[model samples]
Target chain A: MNNMRVLAEEEETSDGVEVTWEDQQQINTFAKLNARLKGIEDKLEQLKQEKEALDDLSTELELTDEDQTVLYKLGESFLHLPQPDALVRLEIDQASVSSQLAKLGAVAEECERGMKDLKVRLYAKFGKAINLDE
Target chain B: MVEQKFPESLDKNPRGIPKAPFIANVEEYIGGPDGDVEGPLKDFQDAIAKYRYMDGSLTQRRKGLEDKIPDIRKTLQMVEFLKQRRDRKQKADDQEDDLEEDDENSEGAKKPLTTTFELNDTLFAEAQLDDTDTVYLWLGANVMLSYEIPEAITLLRSKLDAAETSLKTAIEDLEFVREQLTVMEVNTARMYNWDVKRRRERRSAEEAAKREKES
Candidate 1:
């Protein structure tokens, strides 16, 4: 029990929660992060017990109603957690590509303006509408 | 009806739960005989039963108090994180503006030209707050702290709506929990009182003193 207590990051909260979807998410996220950190939180102790649980089948062991719930929770936790390293690398590459595309767009606009300026300079000096299009 | 979302329903799983003993303990604790008592439960069923009236009163107060603390602490967390984010973002934004102004000049000694572009503060404020803030905050992003104030204001309006549901449900659940704790305290006090009463009646003053405890 002491080891479990040591593992959990004890929050010095004195009150129970005021239930809300937002609040529920906060609590669950806390739990999931705790799972990653192996936080010796009060709930994790409860979870550890479930992990090693026996015949009740209603918890984390096998397929029971509760087991269904825990697995789903684990899935949700994983889903919300940041993407895997490979996926994150891919995302970074995509972002770099997009930023370069934007830079290209800005360069294109600047070139268009520069071309217009050059066209006026040529017309001013040559004093003729040369068929630049040809 | 407002959506009733409990921890069990949080993750949408169609599979199963484990048969852990701790889970059973938690379940039993929440669903015990005197555990569900509400509204300052009678002293006889409480842990504070050693005290008949006045001491039982203190025990009840303590239980009622324990309920608001978590909410208060959470609210405090929301506030502190927001303040920190707001400061950091504001400083960074100010620095960026200065840097942009510097870029507009080739020579550092040249007088900075004032631009006619006036930024609308309201636009900036609105842009900071949106639905994604909550998820960001939940994911523990410190940057979302910058969105705290505006989100709080915007969330307040919707909260009035969601509050009707969340608060009602929260209040109901709070009341239920309060009752359970209150009864436990009171029962404890009452049992102490009964023991003391027996000792006093039997002229065993020392035993009475042993049983005499604060609720």
Candidate 2:
């Protein structure tokens, strides 16, 4: 017979319970395919979680223009203020806000690139498997 | 005689690193011929000292800064900023270290199911099937395959993890950007809405007409 099992739990007790090559191949192939399906499912879950986290981050980013406007106006008002104490404080505060916004803008661009890359990858890999959520 | 050895980073490949003679003519002349051969050993003493100081622990200094965060974290916003800042810093350091090791042998090694020849004990132990009797040409258990299967699974899990984190982080970043842009966009639309612009233009025209009426 061209069929055999290298070893099996059931066969430890029972003798000559031969497994065919065809059966072994079938089993191996099935195992591999099952593993592949599982991988896809896991990836899908990960992407979903990623989407959630992105949503949370976006909330932090929602106020750029208003933030800038408030900051710039404060700076302008500080220059006009006669009191040196208040003027210096407001000027420093304005500078800090501008710097923070600049940093935030940089981080925002990075996030956009990452999201775009993920979208492209998902489209390429899972276009057939899942629907892209708006 | 003390021989000069190469740095650890220089010894990656199979071939041995070439050792160079230490040139210390001034010390060599005073130490005699035999002592000249070993003259560089003193230089090594200096190397060791330099290494200790240059790459020595910043633990004390860093600890002081880290110590302050906990006290600051009593407030809500500060705590959130600290957590985010810490995570980013840790990841950045990990990336720098990974780059030194090159892409293949770094964190990428533990990545999803595709296997290469390197032996990793954790994956090996997890993947191995229980070996049954017989040392040679064993007819029963497929030990080789069972081992491969489990390791592959472990690798796959790591890969999936990386993919998941990246996707989530990206989305968070994009959402922030869009919302930020929209805030300005919303303000612009409010100030320049079609109805408002039209009304402003009409008001201007009416003011001019009133001036003509007055004349």
Candidate 3:
């Protein structure tokens, strides 16, 4: 009853299915949320691939202070850092970097929760998925 | 000319938000002296052109925002993934005390791992990897350096953090664009409805005058 009141203005076409102005607005919102969800999923997959690449690189070497000059990326440029110092800094920086991952994971989960909320609302309103493409 | 009043429903509600100025101007042009439709018709055309220009630019801006969201999302995801991988390894490393065991056995460990090293696209060399030998990392821009595994993981993590910050900003921008697009859609709909009502009134009045003259 409350939903019907909220969806107050209904228009009946030649064929008898009832639709409201509110429903149209909700449908548009649903479509936009769906698009955003897709973007989030794609980004997550790319992050995984980058991690795997780093794992492979780490498995291949035994670095020490006596080794050749090490190149570290700084913005768009690469600068030479002493192999020993680079190793020390990287080891120290790893803990903070790992924590950053945890924070990002939380953000990703929040995004998913928001999407689920929108999806439930959309399903309740339409009874079934509305095919805007058609 | 018969002074016929337009329907009350067609009149703009004074209590509500003012109707688009273009619609009111068109009414004045069509309803004005000599009842010349051309001046008002030109005004109508200019309004449509202006509306279309605004619509096109807004749509283009939305599309640009959409394209950028995915790219930024990818960078964010990459950082997250690297962090995850590092965390997992750190967990396993914490449970074990044999972090240097592999390297220690590399010298006396009887297994000479014969591996092919690809020096260049068409060049390869057979080399024996000792258990203690360090791994060489190919840092982009043709630079290579040997690093302990933990150091390498940390280095990658820093990159991930940088990427994540950029992605967060990009997503915020995308959300702002989405909000703007929704507002644009509502305004466009209201303007279109107003224009149609004005056209209908003009057509019906012309039809009524023609009928009266014929009789």
Best candidate (score: DockQ): 3
Off by over 4 Å in 3: A1-32, A35-43, A63-69, A76-83, A92-100, A132-134, B1-174, B186-215
| Model 3's interface RMSD | 13.4
For B164-189, candidate 3 gives per-residue lDDT tens digits of 55555445444434433453354344
lDDT of 1: 0.35
TM-score of chain A of 1: 0.31
DockQ scores of all models, one per candidate: 0.01, 0.01, 0.06
Worst lDDT run of 10 residues, candidate 1 chain A, spans A72-81
In model 2, which residue pairs have backbone atoms overlapping below 3 Å? Answer: A6-B140, A7-B140, A7-B141, A50-B168, A54-B171, A54-B172, A58-B175, A58-B176
| Whole-model Cα lDDT of every candidate shown, in order | 0.35, 0.36, 0.47
Candidate 2 C-alpha lDDT tens digits along B91-194: 65587677654443233222221212214433321121122211121123764332232334344345445544554443333333223233323222322232
Fraction of native Cα contacts kept in each candidate? 0.00, 0.00, 0.02
Q: Please, what are the lDDT tens digits per residue for candidate 2 over residues A56-104?
A: 4335334333312111112111111123222333444445445545554
Could you give the DockQ of candidate 2? 0.01
By TM-score rank, best first, the candidates go 3, 1, 2
CAPRI band for model 2? incorrect
